[model samples]
Target: MSTIDRRTLLIATGALACVGSAHGHGEPKHPNTGAPVAKEQQPWGIAGEARRATRTVDLRMLDSMRFVPDRLAVKLGQTLRLRIRNTGAVLHELVIGTPAALDEHAALMLRFPDMQHDEPWMAHVPPGKTGEIVWTFNRAGEFAFACLIAGHYQAGMAGRISVRAA
Candidate 1:
């Protein structure tokens, strides 16, 4: 899988926020490719390559701003299904990307807290609810997953992802 330019990703995410707000967050376009992820006719990004999960990771989001087992490990080329449960009494999200990208996105969410959309690498989980994000770790790198709900990130709601060799 190929990486998306940081600038391009940020621009796409910003556009997604704008379009999502205008469309009432009802499934706008995939920002990476400017098409619906449901269309199955386009590629979103490197993180968009979801396949049958070879591993299942169970994580818990806490109200105190923490992710249980915050540091996750996956082999390169391995597909995973992240099963996230919100044990918190509020909304939380899991967005996977580089630290810089996540930091930028967290700031964006702080500005537009109500903005919403579905992306291959994002999973929004409500209180007492569960969500899943299927993804393939194609590259070897240290990445991140975070909850970008307004003050959440500042409250220390984030995790590390280590994708190593196959």
Candidate 2:
């Protein structure tokens, strides 16, 4: 997965506070291959070893364009499985990352408009289908998980992840 460190996020946000065009932010590129990366993962968290889930939270994507419970609390280092279901009529995806990266990617989506991408931190689901994500909250900070499906995000398809110290 393409992960963005704190420094990159700060610089990007500091430049694009208004969520304007991502000029000078450089093309979103894959970290390893130097190839263009799409919707890169922010440095907030890593791909978890989800062999087993300590707990499970079922978050449903509704036609209202929102997650059932918009806020989740997890202790740092807690690995949990997210059972995601799409109850809407369109495609939806749950993407976990820093708010900065999410906003940047959302802006990018507005530009490309048809970019389809996925990563370990993401779960794509279609209407009436269910998807799953195993995530470990390794860091004790505020992160986010949102549906980056073009207008879905702007329509309020998002949630907050609060990882308190374990």
Candidate 3:
């Protein structure tokens, strides 16, 4: 008889779920490596072309589980280039999505700490590294961005995006 420990079983289950499901922010990367999947429009906005970015915002993720300039405001129809620098000693990510979506995604991360997904609205950076995400806010509403790595979100590594009507 073979016995599978609870933790191992749970991790295996979580890995399968992450790879098989296309839920929340985006699809999981195959074998945890590759180019990100295609772009899609969320309620907050769609992936913006780099050429269309009207402004660039720089943010830093710290080991304290915080983002500098956590609050951002932009006009509708404007595209933004987010330049993210991870000053933390561990991996950090910036995933832009609706608040509800971000919450759900964060929960998933808690379950599968090794889960890896990629999207245009997301940037995963290692320690002392930088990444970028270009997004266009077509809808006028509130959005959010967070580091959904395990306990980061719960630690309040999040920020708000306000897209005002033009």
User: In candidate 2, how many clashes are counted?
Assistant: 2
Clashes found in each candidate (C-alpha, N, C closer than 3 A): 0, 2, 0
Error of 3 at 18 (Å): 8.3
lDDT of 1 by residue, 1-166 (tens): 2355465565666768576333222232333444445422112225433456788899999999999989998887787888999898787888887787788777877788766656668787778978877777777888889988789899999999988886
Question: Which portions of model 2 show Cα errors greater than 4 Å?
Answer: 1-42
- For model 3, the stretches where C-alpha displacement exceeds 4 angstroms are 1-37
C-alpha lDDT of all candidate models, in order: 0.73, 0.71, 0.79
Report lDDT (Cα) of residue 42, candidate 2.
Answer: 40
> What is model 3's C-alpha RMSD?
9.1
Q: Candidate 1, which ten residues in sequence have the lowest lDDT sum?
A: 22-31
TM-score per candidate, in order?
0.79, 0.74, 0.79
Give residue 136's error in model 1 in angstroms: 0.5
1-166, model 3: which lDDT tens digit per residue? 1132234335434654666543333332224344443556667788888888999999999999999989999999999999999898887889887787778777878887766555677888878878888899998988899999889999999999999988
Off-target runs (Cα >4 Å) in candidate 1 are 1-4, 17-51
**Candidate 1: residue 89 lDDT (0-100):** 78
lDDT of candidate 2 over 78-125, digit per residue (tens): 888899988988777788877777887777767756554545677877
Q: How close to the true structure is residue 132 of candidate 2, measured as C-alpha lDDT?
A: 78
